[model samples]
Target: MRVLILGGTREARDLAAALVDEPGVTVTTSLAGRVRDPALPAGETVIGGFGGVAGLRAFLRARGIEAVVDATHPFAATMSAHAVAACAPPGHGDDPAGALAGDPAGPGSVPLLQLTRPGWTPGPGDDWHRARDLPAAADRARALCPPGRGVFVTTGRRQLAPFATDRDRHYLIRAVDPPTDVLPPRHTVVLDRGPYTVDGETRLLRAHDVRVLVTKDSGGALTVAKLDAARTLGLPVVMVDRPAATGPVPPTWPDVAGVLAALRGLAAGGQAAPPA
Candidate 1:
């Protein structure tokens, strides 16, 4: 069976690793090319965009892809929607979500699966400040401290340019690698990897006297340690809400383990190809 895996994180790697040895199963992991020096997966790997749903559909048909599993970052809404649209019967004319409107094939189409980690919930003693968008988050973060407040910006490199737009403000940005293109000035760049711990995050927050924190709701425990630290330090956290996913909302696995279980079910011919 041929499987295409949309990947950009370690969880994707883990899933690829688990499936690498499966007999008669060929796994290809597609990266979003947002990260620098991403953790490579085993087996076939493809980087860059799929040119949206149409391009993805063509690729799937050309590749003879039998099944698709979307293991992208929870925040990667566009690609997720594209995956569903491509797999669904062409041009049913309905909204991106699985309405009867689109489906050119009428009913039968390829199987699509989603692997999503659980989102973070605030606990007691958590000083959570919610922002509707990234720009708002940056504005709030800047307003919290005039200068030298040791701001921590973890909103990923994509939105960093906006925060940096406020040149008068100084920020301590944390990303896996230094941002390539446009970025805000007056910032200290910290090049390190994530999946940090609460203890480690707390230490970093306290050490920097971080008065304000900014990050996206990217869900999963590995990156949520800073949220806890923000709560502990009584620091104001400017959180960007996750974007709404467009298209059919497939069965969402709680984690990689659940994904494995689903894969097993599919492997048994019990799930992958649902009867027409």
Candidate 2:
């Protein structure tokens, strides 16, 4: 059986590692290649885009992929939709004269499984402002605080482009790695990941002279330590909500144990066999 795993997160790596050495399983993990220093997966790894649904379908057909597991970040809604569209049956409007969105039909369409981390919920005494999008988040950030105040941004590099597009405020940007593109004139980059301690984030905020923070709704204890740190410092945060996603939600496990169980079930039911 051959599986294509869409990954960039810890969950993605865990799933890929779990299936890498399984009997009769050939797992290929795909990364978006956005991170400057991305963590490598244990199995076959491919970096970059598959050109959306059409590209994904063709690749699946050619590679004889049996199943697709979308373990991308929760914010990667576009890629997640492509996986579903690639696997979805042709609509009534599909014409013989024209090709569909994804690849041509093969032995059968691939099955899709989703592995998403949940979003965080607000707690008492937390000063949180919600925004509809990145631009809105920026607007709220500016309106919520005064200039020259220290600010910590954890919204990832892609979204940061918009915030820095027309902003004149100074910021302390924290990400897993340095940004690929130019930042705002007054922005400073902090390369790190969290589970950051309260004192660690507090010191970071103080060191950068930040009075506010901005982040996405990527939920999980591993990355949420910043929230506690912010609250402890009495800093207000702007949290960008997650976009809607597609596919059947996979079971959540502390680690890869649950994913292994799901893989075992797929094998036992003979669903792991590649389509002819």
Candidate 3:
């Protein structure tokens, strides 16, 4: 059995690790190459984009990929749409009236599954402010804080432009790679990546005297420490909402274990059943 895993997140890594010992199964992990130094999975790997839907279809047909598992970030709606379009039958047409008119997938297409981690829910003593997008989150963060207050921003490097307009608030920005573009004059960039610890997060927050935290709702255990630290300090969080999936949505699993079980069943001659 051949599997192509669209990977970037921790769940994708876990799935790749889990499949290492499976008999007669070959796994190839594909990364988008957005991160400067992405952690490699334990299998054959390919880096960078496949052009678009047409390019992806050509590659899949050429490579004889039997199944596809889209384990990308929830915010990666464009890539998800392209995957669906690429997997559709040769003559499949787009849906003009649907949300994703540019891309569409027909029924009985290539087997595709989406592996997503559950979103975080606000618990007791947590002060959460939700925003529809990055701009909204930045505005909300500014509104929630007094002038010149420190804010911790962890919404990745690409989305920092909106927050850069707020010159009054000081920002402690954290990302895997350093930002190249100019930011707010009062901001400090912390070049790093996670699995962050609660102690480290708490110390960082306290040391910066962060009055607010601005982040995307990228729900996973790896970055949840920041949320925990914020809660402990009674700080307000401005969370940017995840973009809705475009085009035909594939069956989704919330964890790597469920995806592994489904893949194993498929390898054993069973149908590619949806994760329960």
Best by TM-score: 3
User: Which rank order by lDDT, best down to worst?
Assistant: 3, 1, 2
Give candidate 2's TM-score: 0.83
- Residue runs of model 3 more than 4 Å from their true location after superposition: 93-108
Summarize candidate 3's per-residue lDDT along 170-260 as a digit string, tens digits: 9999999888656877998999888999999999999988999998899999999999999999999998888976566767789988777
Any runs in candidate 1 off by more than 4 Å, and if so which? 93-108, 165-168, 272-276
After superposition, candidate 2 runs with Cα above 4 Å error: 90-107, 165-168, 180-182, 246-258, 270-276
For each candidate in the order shown, give its overall lDDT on alpha carbons.
0.75, 0.73, 0.82
lDDT of 1 by residue, 50-134 (tens): 8988888889888987667889988888888888778776664244334211212444355677877766777887767788788
Specify the poorest-scoring 10-residue window by lDDT in model 2. Answer: 92-101
Sequence-dependent TM-score of model 1: 0.86
Task: List the pairs of residues colliding in candidate 2.
Answer: 150-209, 150-210, 150-211, 151-210
The global Cα lDDT (0 to 1) of model 2 is 0.73
